[model samples]
Target chain A: EAGVTQSPTHLIKTRGQQATLRCSPISGHTSVYWYQQALGLGLQFLLWYDEGEERNRGNFPPRFSGRQFPNYSSELNVNALELEDSALYLCASSRRGNLNYGYTFGSGTRLTVV
Target chain B: QKEVEQDPGPLSVPEGAIVSLNCTYSNSAFQYFMWYRQYSRKGPELLMYTYSSGNKEDGRFTAQVDKSSKYISLFIRDSQPSDSATYLCAMNGVGYGQNFVFGPGTRLSVLP
Candidate 1:
């Protein structure tokens, strides 16, 4: 089976600009999650979408938002990006809404804010 | 205190050595534990998962959870160079749609 897939393996943006990272979950998966992995900061959860609804979010600001489309694909949008926003954006999907089901992650998009 | 605390060690070990990685959590409500391994420039892959307080083994990997002490561990037996990566520990409660709190991963290098 195909694992999760992310687009534009790498991205570069200037300060104050916006960045969008996309993800396609595996077949039959319905929930998508977004995370930020900054250098030395580990993985920080960003957003969670299930069945096209915003289910939960992390401690991120409103500028860090995203949505899951009807097809279970997701897009993570970081608005007015700052230097601190530079990090690898990861997307994962699980078979169910519960955390115990485990997540399948995609090769993340490396976002570099200049 | 942070929900999860992990030593960010870039530990170097010889191939075939036994490796032990650990993390301590502050939240007693967390009942599910997970371990993820991330390669360079790639997303983390789930390595192991366990519920409550106990030990689960899969081939060369073992995961242990101690709720009383709020500690979790991942053991790699006969470690190989292919195992060189960062290991992250995560935990969450029984609620649906809950976020899996993650720790700052520990980097491991199994030198062949």
Candidate 2:
């Protein structure tokens, strides 16, 4: 089976601009998750979407929002981006809402906010 | 303290050596443990996942979880240079859609 896939492997934006990253979950997966990996930092949870509904989110600001499409693909929007927003944004998917089911992550999009 | 704490080790070891990586979590409710291996500039790949306190062996990799101490470990036997990568430990509670808390990755370098 094809694994999780992400689009626009890299993105370049400036402060005050908006950055959008996209991800397509593995086929038959219903849960999509977003994470941020800043330099020298661990993966930070951004958002979670299951069955086209927002399930939960991390401590990130409101400007960081996203939605899951009907096909189970997801998009992450970082508005009013700052230099610190320059990081690898990762997307993952699970077959179900349970975390015990494990997750499959995409290669991620490298966002360079200049 | 962070929910999950891990040593950010640029651990360098010789090939064929036994390598150990670990993480400690503050949340005792986390019943599921996972380890992910990430290459430079790449996303994390699931290495091993365990549901409880026990040892699960797969090939040369073994994962052990100690619920009493809130400690989890990954052991790589007969390690190879290709094993060089960042290893991240993640855990989740029993609630529906519990967030997976990840630790600062431990960087490992297996030199041939």
Candidate 3:
């Protein structure tokens, strides 16, 4: 079984520019989650999408947003990126309605805001 | 205070030594606990999961959760150099769409 997959292994964007990251969940998975892992800071949840609907989000600002497609793939958009926005953005997938089971994570997209 | 607190240890140990990692959470509602091992430049892989409290052992790994103290622990017996990585502890409540709170992670290096 293929695990979660993320595109653009590494991305470099200038300040004030926009960046987009993509993720593809595993087969038969319906829930996709986005997280940011900054240096020294642990994994911080960004967004949660299930069945193409945004279910929950973290304390991040509105500039950090994303959506899930019908096929359970997801896209995370960071608008007006700042130097603080540089981090490894990870995508995870799990079976819908199963909170007890842990998620499977992708290698992550390393975003560097210059 | 943060919801979960873990010592960010760059702990070095001998290959055959026992390794112990722990995390303490402030939220009492968090019922599900998990430990993940992440390699350099790679995403975290779930190592163990437990609900509420008690101990679960898998091979050389053992996970323990104490609901009263809101503490969780992971133990590795006879560790190997392959276990060198960051171990992260995550937890969440019972809600379906609930998000997990993760620790800063402890970096472990086992020398062969």
- C-alpha local distance difference test of each model: 0.92, 0.92, 0.94
lDDT (tens digit, per residue) of candidate 3 on B1-112: 9989998999999999999999998888899899999999999999999998999999999999999998999999999999999999999885634678899999999999
Off by over 4 Å in 3: B94-96
DockQ for every model, please: 0.79, 0.75, 0.88
lDDT of 2 by residue, A1-114 (tens): 998899899999989999889999999999999999998878999999999999999999999999999999999999999899998999999977555557899999999989
I-RMSD for candidate 2: 1.4
Query: RMSD of model 1, in Å?
Result: 1.2
Model 2 chain A worst lDDT run, 10 consecutive residues:
A95-104
- Among incorrect, acceptable, medium and high, the docking class of model 2 is medium
What lDDT score is found at residue B36 in candidate 2? 95
Give chain B TM-scores in order.
0.96, 0.96, 0.96
The superposed Cα distance between candidate 2 and the true structure at residue B94, in angstroms, equals 2.9
What clash pairs does model 3 have?
Answer: none
Model 3 Cα lDDT, one tens digit per residue, A1-114: 998999999999999999999999999999999999999999999999999999999999999999999899999999999999999999999998786669999999999999
Full candidate order by lDDT, most accurate first: 3, 2, 1
lDDT of 1 by residue, B5-72 (tens): 99899999999999999999987888889999999988999999999999999999999999999999
Global Cα RMSD, each model: 1.2, 1.1, 1.0
